[model samples]
Target: MGLLWGITLLWAFSFSLIGVYLAGQVDAYLAVASRMALALLVFLPFWRPLPWRQALVLMATGAIEIGIMYLFLYKSYQYLTVAELLLFTIFTPLYVSLFADLFARRWPKHLWAPALLAVAGAAVIRWTELSEDYWKGFALIQAANACFAFGQVWYRHQSKSTSLTHRARFAWFFLGALLVTALASALLADWQKLPVTPVQQGVLLWLGVVASGLGYLGWSYGSTLVSAQQLAVMNNMLIPAGIVVNVVIWQGQVDWLRLGLGSVCMAGALWLCRRQSS
Candidate 1:
């Protein structure tokens, strides 16, 4: 549990920082493609070759899980600030909770108020992004967040199956993710022109190996270890950490009033999550 928490914290920090990197780097999809390629290269040897059957599943998961998510993320980063990007994330847990209720036949109890609070808080945080450009970015990031929620739940379901070791499955998934993201990027992005930088390469490498691969694997493992409700509760902590990290590391502005509102949102969300868990 502690390791999982650490991994998640690292994941959160890494993702927040990647915005600055992506802002300066090559095309977003291309960056994703490159990172996936690098991660695949690193993970394949450790996990061994895969059978064609499992590879297909990996490919599908990768396309939705990585390909589309990265595409829009990059697109969103183009217009949205890191804080704005994260503000949209407040909707993901709410979406997942609602979806789980519809499909699984039981909604998270006592989540209504907290979810609403979170939404309001997020709106306040993102109030500055009411411009047309920010609105578009907001929509894109929301889409990515929705996809990420789906991916986590779907991958959790897969974790329960006996078809393959988690490590191996993760590796195959990375390989498929690379291929899918690469093709998607090629189709969607202009390869003729791209930002070139040494730091960009370094950031991409870190994102691939440390952030996506290990961070995801750890988060998945934690989800499997802990109840979804508990994980959901803890997930709110990421907001404060994100805000702080942004203010300190990125030299971003701090709106104390918004931060206070975010705290209330997190408190409500946590309370609801705990209640749901019990």
Candidate 2:
């Protein structure tokens, strides 16, 4: 849970940074490819052999979760405001809860209430008038959300190895992501849009090394420790956290009333889940 919380803060900054610094300035495919490549480099040294089956599963997880998901996310930014993108992701908790239950073949009914509450909290925080591109951006973000939710649940349940084993072989996950992103960048990227400025390059390096590499590792491992309900609720935490980052760093306008209300709702959701579990 602590790991998840820590990564949540780190990823909140990532959300703001990408939206402000990289989304429109850099080629989406190139950004994704570069990030994955850099992350791959970080883990490559620790790589070890795993059974063919486990290796394949982890690779597939990475490809879908980060590789394909980033494609949807980065492209959606062209059609959506950062706030809209964040708001649309409110559905992710529901997706996570549903996928976790489906994979387990048993419904933990208690999970649903808290998950729904978390979604409501996120919705409250970002509610606004809809633009013409709402449906398109919504669809793209939903696809990304579903893929991310599925990957987290699948990896948390399917990977039965000890922590040491997971670390030793985790590079394969990024390799799989790299294959997808690299292929996309090669085929679809606008070469003219590559990062040229020092800030862009530095941001890419930070995102790739610390955010993608360390953040994903922490998040994946953290998922193994918490209940699916807790993980589901935690997904919504990113919304307020990201908004706070934007407010602090980017001087983005924020509605204090809504922020306070949403925070209360999310806290209530967390408390409810914890009480139920206890």
Candidate 3:
């Protein structure tokens, strides 16, 4: 949980940094590829070969979680306002909860209420009127959300059975992500939009090394430490945390009433999950 919370705070600033510094200036595929490559470098030194099947599974999880998710997510930003993107992400907790159940081959009726509550909380913070033609953006975000949720659920379940520590085998995960993102960059990245400024370069370094590398390491491992309900609820914690960072550091506008109410709702969801675990 500490690792999870720490990474959440670390990533809270990432949204603003990307929106302010990299969104239009840098090619999204290139940024994704750069981040994955840097992250792979971080873990590569610690890599130990796993069973062929385990290695493939981790790679597949990485492909779905970060590679495909980032592809869908960055592309959707073109069609949706940042607010709309945030709003649509509220569904992620629901997806996480549902996917966990699907993977486990049984429904944990106990988890659903808190997952739905967390979604409601995030919606309160982020929901706004959608653009008339928002369906494409919505679909893209949902696909991203579903992929991310499924990946987390899959990894958590699989990690329980693996003898290798996460660090020993984690490089394979980023290698898989790099393969997808590198291919996408080769095919689709806008050459003219590559980062040219010192600020942009620095931001990418921070995002790649610290955010993508350490952040995902922490999040993936932390997901294995908690109940599925807790993990699902925790996914929504990023919404309020990111909003607060945007509001405080970036001077982004937010409705105080919604922020407060939504935060309370999120807190309640976490509390409910704690009670269930106890």
User: lDDT tens digits, residues 81-191, model 3?
Assistant: 988998999999899989989988896688899999999989898888889888999999999999999999998988878778888667999999999999999999889
TM-score of each: 0.82, 0.95, 0.98
Show pairs that collide, candidate 2: none
| TM-score of candidate 3 relative to the true fold | 0.98
| Candidate with maximal lDDT | 3
lDDT of 1 by residue, 1-278 (tens): 57556875676576556667665546767777877877776667667666677677766666667767777777787787866677677776676556545545675675455556656666565455444568888789888876766666666666676567667777777776787787887688767536466776778778888877777667766767765554544555566666677788788778888778867776676666566667
The residue-level lDDT of candidate 1 at 192 comes to 53
**Which residue segments of model 1 deviate by more than 4 Å?**
1-4, 48-54, 77-84, 107-121, 124-126, 132-138, 192-196, 233-236
Candidate 2 per-residue lDDT over residues 1-278, each given as its tens digit: 89999999999999778878887799989998999999999998899888888788889999988998888887787788866887798999899999988988986678799999999998999887778757888899999999899989988877664454666556988988999999989899999998999999999999999999998999998998888889999998988898898899899889989998998999998898889889
In candidate 2, how many Å is residue 119 off?
A: 0.3
- What 10-residue stretch in candidate 2 is worst by lDDT? 160-169
Q: In lDDT terms, how accurate is model 2?
A: 0.88
- Cα RMSD, model 2: 1.5
- For each candidate in the order shown, give its overall lDDT on alpha carbons: 0.68, 0.88, 0.91
